[model samples]
Target: MQFIDFKKEHFSHNKEAGHYFIQISKDEVGYGDLEVLEKQDDDTYSKARYELVDDVSKVTIKMKNPGNIRVSF
Candidate 1:
């Protein structure tokens, strides 16, 4: 529930700012996961496997369940 709360806050604040996509990358497997709190339009957001592009800092994620995401940047 805390994660959901955080996700909601992130979406509410960022959606207004036009941040439609959020990517999360980790160095190790099972570091963390993302979950959807709300949905706007037809976008789907959910926890997904990130494709490692470069280092741990760079990653590519597909928004399967469109919603807001909350992760430490």
Candidate 2:
């Protein structure tokens, strides 16, 4: 499970926009969830910050079953 965001003008809206992807087999549980927390154990990472520097127009999710999936941005 991961969120990929390309902060560039040339990447276009599709790739540039944040995308949360999770790959699972059909026979498996087929469930996933994503949450981007501001603080990581009372500390924040350099790349992942609470402040929003760039505006994300769209967020796409790719999964086999999205019924149990939740995304927090």
- TM per candidate comes to 0.24, 0.22
Tens digit per residue, CA lDDT, model 1, 1-73: 2332234333222355343344444542234443333433466444443222333554333333334443332
Name the lDDT of candidate 1.
0.37
Candidates in order have lDDT scores of 0.37, 0.30
- Compute the lDDT for candidate 2: 0.30
Worst 10 residues of 2 by lDDT: 46-55
Q: How many steric overlaps are in each model, in order?
A: 5, 0
Error of 1 at 3 (Å): 9.4
RMSD of each: 8.3, 12.5
Among all candidates shown, the one with the greatest lDDT: 1
Error of 2 at 12 (Å): 22
